[model samples]
Target: MKILFLGQLIGKQSIAFVKEHLASLKAEHQIDCTIAVADAVTGGYGLGKNHAFYLRKLGIDLLLGGEAMLSKRDLVEELAQIHFVLRPANFTGIGNFGYGMRHLHTPKNQQLNIINVMGMMGFHRVHASNPYQLVNKILDNPKHPSPFTLVAFSAIASAEKQTMAHMMAGKCSAIIGYGAKAITLDAQIIDETAYITDVGRISAPFSVAGFTPESEIERYTTQRPRKSEELISDEIELQAVVITLDDETGKATHLQPLRATYPLNVKAPANTSAESTTP
Candidate 1:
């Protein structure tokens, strides 16, 4: 099956690593996958003409652009298929936007699932205030038509992560944490969806830095000095949202993450079980 790995762009520095990863996957596993970088060729942290050109050369089937980057006639017509990753359901940065997919390989195929990721270093909200509204807007937009499975990613403190996890557990498709990074949750599926699998999860590199218990307490004391006078706890929250469009049920289900990390055995819950049963 073909898969698209959507990753963040740090700058030209990622070019080499990006190319190497894709090439190796194609050559070794015969996997048909594309890497969509959130930012690379443009100054606004979105895809630009040059960026698209470079990525295409590197074997990217589709290079995504940000929603806010006005229209470029040449790009609109040329990269139309893969252009404009949908704006996040709720989050919107000045130069940043979101992308949604109707189908993994084809557009307007609501049958397709999409995963949206936003990384937080400290405290800058990435997407929209009302993410659910933003999500609905995307689904209902007439100009850009498509059905989709939506998922979102963000980092958070472990404690807040647990609270969100417990509160949003079963309600989310799969809530996962990146350990002191961000929290991610699905825009849909509310209530009783909690699962024990989301806590203390880590990603591939195993290098994503996590905050120490002590450091967090110190951070709060420094930021909100008076809050220290009250009871304080240490925990980071990281989360991801998973949206699934079930063909059989003809309904889109949303699931929120309880923690930043997902269980090792299950990177993705919805697709994992199906992939196993496919063969």
Candidate 2:
């Protein structure tokens, strides 16, 4: 089975771009299933109910969420009800929210198990259980259902993510690291398991993590409260990774990173020169 795992979707525009190009991308890769991170799919902070439904309509089979999963309170009820959406499994009090693991039957009649877990280090604000322990408990289960398992390990530290990947190298089919919004160059197969440090984001290429550079710079320099981040409307691209699993063994056979530029109809805004003061 071939699975196309896209990077985080930043905002409404990013959603639109995906909707426009997703079918072509699937056809280009002969993809059988599609999955994407839903941390910032609404207005760049959290996934809203409407946006989640729209993403599903666009042919995304599953949605994964990270630390900012519940940033939008409106999505709480929807998450519980939806079977295609998932939050971090190790999150504290996770039973109240949605699930973090799901077993799905793909179009090719293959069972795929997916788990979303958040690291403990660096994410001080998030209260979550130890991801390592949780992952072990699930993978080591006596009656673990699916042989094809994918782990979405979201973390801020590269070392932590790498550690998780190595630990699960021979256990799962793939481990995709995210939450940093930048694609890492270390995409490889380890012990038949596909691993990528970071999957990148599906947003503008000319901005800072898909946001306007000016706004991010100002906020960092000022060290004060600033307005919401503004999404850059130019040079959008879809960055993701595709993993192919053996039909019988459920081990990853191939790992490929994909990047495609979106053709925007509107032209980029021209730079304006500052006027000189009267002499």
**Which structure among the candidates has the greatest TM-score?**
2
* TM-score for each predicted model, relative to the true structure: 0.41, 0.92
TM-score of 2: 0.92
Tens digit per residue, CA lDDT, model 2, 1-279 = 899999988776677776678888899889988999888766567777777777898899999878888766667866778889999999996567888899888888888889999988877557878898899899998244887999999998998899998898999999999999888889999999999999999888787777777777877898765544646674588889999999889899999998878875543322122111100
**lDDT tens readout by residue for model 1, 1-279:** 223333343233334334544465445434344434333223323344555566677776544322222233333344435443433333444332224432354332333444333333333324335433443454455343333232333334345334444544443333333322222332333342222222222122222222234444665567633211111112222222222334343243433332332222211111101010000
Angstrom error of the Cα, residue 17, model 1: value is 2.6
How many clashing pairs per prediction, in order?
60, 0
lDDT of 2: 0.82
